[model samples]
Target: MIASTIKTQYEGSSHDSVLYSKPYSKKIDTLNMPKGYQLPKFMQFDGKGNLKQHVTHFIETCNNAGMEEDYLVKKFVRSLKGNAFDWYTNLKPEFINSWDQLEKEFLNCFYSTRRTISMLELTSTKQWKDEPIIDYINRWRSLSLDCKDQLSETSAIDMCVQGMHWGLHYILQGIKPRTFEVLATRSHHIELSIANHGKKEPITDFKKDKVFAPNIDKIGKKPAKEAFTVNTTPIKTSSTPIKIDVIKDSTQIKPSF
Candidate 1:
């Protein structure tokens, strides 16, 4: 009757359900499974034995992140062990831990910027515009204007690497929840790099100080000399200089009525 009752109530017409089904006993069901089923029950603890909330949090977080549940579980477990796991989590932040997530995000940012800079250079240069992919990549240096002064080389390279990481990480984070701080930190690093490398060719120099000033020679000394000469000649020919007498007013008004 107990077997029949279990079959009638819980078993879903599948024998596999008996062996692998989620905990039926209320006792085991109460405790959350370890991460990725990754760590032993011990590692999740802090010095005080406050079990790390990482495992339960990761599963819920990943499901909310729109990740495949199995994949999320596997990835989380992997993170507990080594770098490969770290890489996956870094590549998928909402599903995993922070360390790898940050690294991947940073790289993604860098790669995208590099591609953008490369594309801009190709369009600007005559030869690379219609060239094959191989040609464009290979001749990037020549095609690209020397942007070194405008942006720093190191910053540009670092940002490119960061961009690569972010691109992957964002799949889990989505377009909205990802903080601007994350985006900005990535973007600023890229901009700094582009600025250091001086490679961003926006085709405009509206930054003010770069604009040319009026020439002093053309505007000031020569024009004044020409005005003076013409006036002097005309004044001499016109008539004798008129003399005027100045009278001093003695009375001063103390206040308006």
Candidate 2:
């Protein structure tokens, strides 16, 4: 009687059978998954071992999503595309056991000790010319991350200051910043100050001098007189005179007679 009563109470639903049987779940319902939490497309790794940055980013994203190891590995596999997907499929047997092992294998395939050395050399020798101080410093910092064992914050600060343009380098040398953060901040402000000063209107009358002014002395001076020759000889007069004396006396005697 008690068994019949219990059976009657649980007969309305399959909940009892579901509790006893482990049914296969073919699909994962991703509806409840966090939005905008998808793995970045650029974060795929082929067999070439050049995806250190991508791997690092993938791990961080998975961690933030609170994924367990099994689910993490599955999600990671699903995220693979193109060459990366092919590589994963070929080695599925080996990496399927553990997420930790998979990560190590992935790194072994892509990350190289020589790459770290190369990054160290670049960071140590790089220089900033016309690039903005902030951009220059950011690039240095990124390269420094790959060679952290070989470089320190203080060393990075010194290298960055040394790589600056001569004008900025000379000014920053006096300040002697001891940390990278402080050095970056001070360099940024110094750059801004230099830019602002360049933009200001230049002094037009700094050294007003009459000597340098346009020569106005010739402006008021009278023009010089032109020289020419004049004729100095006196005008010649006529020198001839007439003689009428004898004929006039003869005519007067005849008139008297």
Candidate 3:
């Protein structure tokens, strides 16, 4: 009666049979662990943080340690703790055959819907009047990580442009979506438009149909002209202009001195 009562307390559960219900297939079970192999403690998942990040960390650790394929399926469970360990303990015995199957199960059990990126947040994003186009695009890129739908570069750029003012929107709408230089060049145009949006812009007062050359500020205000000292001694002069005689074949100026 006592045995039956004890069975009733934990009945219909794997906890009643053993501490853990391993799910390794026959091939995985027959593979012997390498001599002096140690359980890795470099990282552990507690079923609370990002599941994808945990999986990535686990894979990276396995690669760096040169762990064999069978060792990977067998040794990964040792890194779990608390809730993660509890989940592992309940896995069906003699069922898991590969690392991929175990990882898929782990994610299915712990993946949180709250962590999903909101489409509303990505779609409703608006660039502030003074915010830079690069900053706006970068913001979109950053948010794409958590967005529920995986956003493509073209879709991201289109969404970001929708929030921008017409000045930048026009230039960026159909141009190179991922080019940082193009975004930078248009950012100035957006900010300038925003800066001058509501006020009367200052006019240069230039008349139409007349071209005016730019005036250089460094030009002197007046010519440096001064009266020169003339030679007071006068020599006798011929009324006719003096002429120089030259040989037809010679083409050189003769010095009068």
Candidate 4:
């Protein structure tokens, strides 16, 4: 009646069996168990030829308690994801070089009080299903109307373009991105466009016509003013009279008689 009560209380659970069942496991020379020995405890030796106590204990414990191998493998894989490799290989060099600095800059750009990049930077060592880089970027802000409008503003585009320029530089050189050069180039373009966008007083404004003549700024000579010859002398005329002698004088004398 007592055995039946114990059986009823413990049931068939492994924990119950380990605690209540008679000690069925016997300590044998686990080091020299023959091939035919049924359920012989397995053992492992370290490089120094010493038998590891933990291995023997764990095997005996698991066999006594009925632990399976699949559960052990799952736990192992989870551990490898955290400790196997450095996570920064998949990220930009600049970000990896000075994570703290980049985190600060990223925070400045974050919208909706989000810290997506910061979190990834902190947690990338763990294994996960592969995702594209931009997916990682867009995590901080949702694709809502206000977010899109904020991203479309002048300051935002300028920041993005500048960020892209530096990011490319970092990728190409495999080094930390230099903010000075990138920001300088951005500032210069902004100032130039702001100064020369619309007010037209002709400073390198050569886009007036398609075909242009060289040296248009310098004035050319009007072909030598048609050279002319002039005689400046005044004409002198004489006041002279010419007398005509009449040959009819002989006829007139005869008529007079």
10 residues in a row with least lDDT, candidate 3 = 202-211
TM-score of each: 0.17, 0.45, 0.49, 0.14
Candidate 1 vs 2: which has more TM-score: 2
Which has the better TM-score: candidate 2, or candidate 3?
3
Sorted on lDDT, highest at the top, how do the candidates line up?
3, 2, 1, 4
Per-residue CA lDDT of model 4 for 22-123, tens digit only, reads: 111122111233344444233322212212232345345444544333222111111112212122112232232232332333234322332234422322
Best by TM-score: 3
Off by over 4 Å in 1: 1-13, 23-28, 32-154, 157-257
**How many clashing pairs per prediction, in order?**
44, 1, 2, 0
Tens-digit lDDT track for model 3 on 1-257? 88877877757446566655567888887787666666566588888878888888888777667676666888778778989987887788878888888888889999754455698987888888767767776776677778878876666767767877685666555454465455665565545544554354432211132333445388657755544433333333565343344433344534231
Task: Give the Cα lDDT of each candidate.
Answer: 0.36, 0.59, 0.68, 0.32
Q: Which ten residues in a row have the lowest lDDT in candidate 2?
A: 203-212
Task: State the lDDT of candidate 1 residue by residue for 74-170, as single tens digits.
Answer: 3344324343333333342233234344334423433322223454453344323334322322354333433433444443333223323342233
Least accurate stretch of 10 residues (summed lDDT) in model 1? Answer: 225-234
Candidate 2 runs further than 4 Å off: 1-50, 92-95, 111-114, 117-139, 148-152, 176-257
lDDT of 3: 0.68
Order of the predicted models by TM-score, top scorer first: 3, 2, 1, 4
